[model samples]
Target: MPLHPFLSKTKLYKFLKTICKPFHVVFKYTEFVAFIDENRNKGKINDYYNKSTAYKNRFQLHDKLLEELKNKPIFYYEFGVAGGDMIKKWSLTNKVETSRFVGFDSFEGLPESWENKKEGHFDQKGNFPDINDSRVSFVKGWFQDSVYKALLDSEFNEQCVYHLDADLFSSTLFVLFQIFPKLKTNDILIFDEFSSRDHEFEAFEIFKKCTNNKWQFEFIGAVNNYRQVAFMLK
Candidate 1:
């Protein structure tokens, strides 16, 4: 009879080796040490942020920005308004009486596959968060279709804060290029998935190289193992 895949001689031998005397002991100890080290690192990060002016969460960061821009006529743009949760929060927490909140999303998920995620991964089909605030509005289409048109109609000639959460290289790049000319020193830019090497990170690198713009890393927030980075145009 043909050998079963799971019970093949090589597999059995490896299994036996794993469970053997010193090897098993060593493996368990190594795993335990790794677990402890990971927890220690996470704890350090949390403790440091807890004691610093640097925000420990995205909401806190937004709150700080709102405070700083209070009573000013600021323009805030949020890309990838998934479920509209953050936008709604911004609308409610906003202290700037004349500020505008613009959110852009395809409402149909990603335009293309990113890494292991296939295209249409986050499609919401135009469903957005319900906000009664008149200052809040949305551009419901892909970045390429909606950004320029929205900008043309908007009364946003002043510096603005850009929250990029699209999580795709193409979408992020398109938006960055479209808005590059309007960005000025001291303007803030937030990258929701900045750690994703092939997506947001790559897009930002390309934008920096192409524009020769200088940016200062200002803050970082970590939650549930996901990280967000903020930068200031300089």
Candidate 2:
């Protein structure tokens, strides 16, 4: 039996996007890489890769990614949930049973600069769009000063997944320290803008330095959007 015309096109496009988006990114990245090489662009292609959705979606594979962290009571705690886009998409794809996702932000805008890099998208504070998920909540505050002290109550300590997209060294370190006690060997941690930012990387390094190798860490899959890294905690 033939499907309705509207449903067929919708399904077809969904299938095509799932199959072709990664290829599109790789192809575009190859071209961008070639352009940089030919013009001696001095790593501008890196920035281009950071802005690609193909790369971002690769990091958002919640089904496989979250399944790897399924033993404990999981909580997807995100530092910055702009428009709740990633959370929304992840909820659609993942088979989460005991996981609750919490997104924290100034939502207003980024906090004052704690590092050398002076550019970020949240220059002015704004309100988040209405969230439809029962499991997701947006907390408004700066993560460094407020997130841990304000929100880390009895309920949040039971989380297993922490996505640190705080975009500042202080906030990243804050999450590491504040959340460290709650992290079990089965937990997973993700840094949404860590690879290019040396300061954020240093936070992870410092955390690792203090832990004496009790926690096992790995960079999962390929580099996504050039900067974000999904790390599986073992």
Candidate 3:
């Protein structure tokens, strides 16, 4: 299906593309610089400049927030919960006594091909992590079906921390639109593929434009050489 008519021709679309162009250049330049720096030093690049650093920074930020909100109820959501590794870690490490952790995935994987990849490329054949934590639950289906059902059932109401790992334009956009209205200031959003121009990045661009700038987010950290990024809603 085609996008809404308003989505195709808008100033926001142009503006977002304009802003994003520089980042593409910067990423390429940084890669070149890192290669040279590593060769000059006669050593492998340090963890400080890699995905490990991003994960460390992202988790540290989440930890700080968890500490601050320890006494309050928090709804933590993990999209694209493949293998459930991160969500399981979060459930175990979270200090918030009233926090609820929810993981969403098709369990059958990519609804469609992404960036020259074939459809169902990440399929897990319904094999998801068996998280034993009582605070965690899993939604099994595509975002279009499961997410909309959750919304209609009023399963989401409180402020949330979102971990978006869905790596396709359609999947990300579908999830974003479903949850955008519920997002609020202070909520944290973590994107595992933020720099992918044709996927998460494009979804976010459309989302920002469609929302008419009603909300803003501040960058917190990035990992995997900026393949992942965390932001705080403001």
Candidate 4:
């Protein structure tokens, strides 16, 4: 998935805000916009603000969780890993080969109903780049309709960080139901688009019902104006 221009701008602005917050807010705002354009021109940014920020937050939480679960290994599984950017970065930076990074995507575009994804959503066509690392792999097809079949056809091990970023409500709901029974204590589930009013929120409500109030989630942080990531401890 190529980066959306609007999303990139938003991410650059956010990073700037965090670093420049304490030093004269009004002046910092002006500087932030200028820095964003400079960075854009230098081509130092990737297109996925939502996923990148979510990955960063998960790692932060993971560090805390790691201290709590010291002996246990770390692993991450994500639904809808567009362009495989987060997986690549985390694998390289963290250097955790034992901690598997699994990504699932249709590798095509969003389902027809997802056409209304307002804040820079699109149908990504074709497969992700060849990831040489054995720790990461991409599962192709819609998780909502094909989850069972996919699992039966393949395999996914236990994961510490489970990211749900699929744009469609039904697809996200399917993942919740499919993965719910497998969740264990201290497992973290991150919902990248939870701030969206429609699909993501609706899916969360359904997840609450399906979970029978057993699983509880809370917002960890906001990615930007268009997206926020939520964390569920299981």
TM-scores for the candidates: 0.69, 0.63, 0.70, 0.62
Give the better candidate number (1 or 2) by lDDT.
1
Give model 3's TM-score versus the native structure.
0.70
- Runs in model 3 deviating more than 4 A are 1-72, 154-158
> Tens digit of lDDT per residue, candidate 4, span 1-234?
676687566688577668877665555445444433433322111232444344355444334434543444556777888777666655555455466777788877566456455532544666685678887777777776556665564334544777787867877888888877667766777666664445675687678876787865533333343254445464
- Against the true structure, whose lDDT is highest? 3
Model 2 TM-score? Answer: 0.63
lDDT of each: 0.71, 0.62, 0.73, 0.61
**Ten-residue stretch with the least lDDT total in model 1:** 43-52
Ranking by TM-score: 3, 1, 2, 4
Model 1 Cα lDDT, one tens digit per residue, 145-211: 8899888787656568899989998999999998876777778787777656667867877897887
lDDT of 2 by residue, 139-213 (tens): 777776567664546364454667787777777887788877777765667776664344566687778888786
Error of 1 at 181 (Å): 1.0
Candidate 3 residue lDDT tens string, 14-48: 77788899898787657545533543322111123
**Could you tell me which residue pairs clash in candidate 1?**
109-123
Clash count for candidate 1 is 1
* Lowest-sum lDDT 10-residue window in model 4: 39-48
TM-score (C-alpha) between model 1 and the true structure? 0.69
